[model samples]
Target: MDQPQNNPKAYWRENLRYLILLLTLWFLVSFGAGILFKEELNAIKIGGFGLGFWFAQQGAIYVFVVLIFVYVRLMNKLDRKYGYDEEA
Candidate 1:
């Protein structure tokens, strides 16, 4: 019987795709909102603080935490799809 082969390259490609996407979102939230769009965001107020200020101080951290969870969830799914899950 021929054993099935696992393609590490494909798995790594998918992993990289998820990493790039999540990192891009983190960068956008941290740098784009905090700096590039700060002037525009400052026009809006969030809890008596400028939107930019909030993003620079608190929002970025919140987004990073959420991203961490998202990455875990996505990687879990990926692992299952690739038959690499420990449960298997």
Candidate 2:
């Protein structure tokens, strides 16, 4: 509460950075592997399914779930860094 306005701005900037990075990663994994590199990835199979097809079907969703957890963890750390209190 004692921090200046610029301090919160810095915190918001950092938050956006995290979001951009994570979202980009998700997009690349989902769109790249599933669509762009499908044929190449098909060479590698997983549980009788082509890697690319797996990604197109279920892998992206799994990745999204993991990313959700990662985001939550990152946000928790970021909140602590910015001295944010959930109860407040």
Q: Which structure among the candidates has the greatest TM-score?
A: 1
- Stretches of candidate 1 off by over 4 Å are 1-5
> What TM-score number comes out for model 1?
0.92
For candidate 1, the 10 contiguous residues with the lowest summed lDDT are 1-10
- As for candidate 1, its clashing pairs are none
What would the per-residue lDDT of candidate 2 be over residues 1-88, giving only the tens digit for each residue? 6543336888899889999999999999899999999999999999998999999999889999999999999988777777784743
TM-scores of the models, in the given order?
A: 0.92, 0.88
Best by lDDT: 1
What is the C-alpha lDDT profile of model 1 across 1-88, one tens digit per residue?
2432356788899999999999999999999999889989999998899999999999999999999999999999888777788988
Clashing pairs in 2: none
User: lDDT of each prediction vs. the true structure?
Assistant: 0.90, 0.88
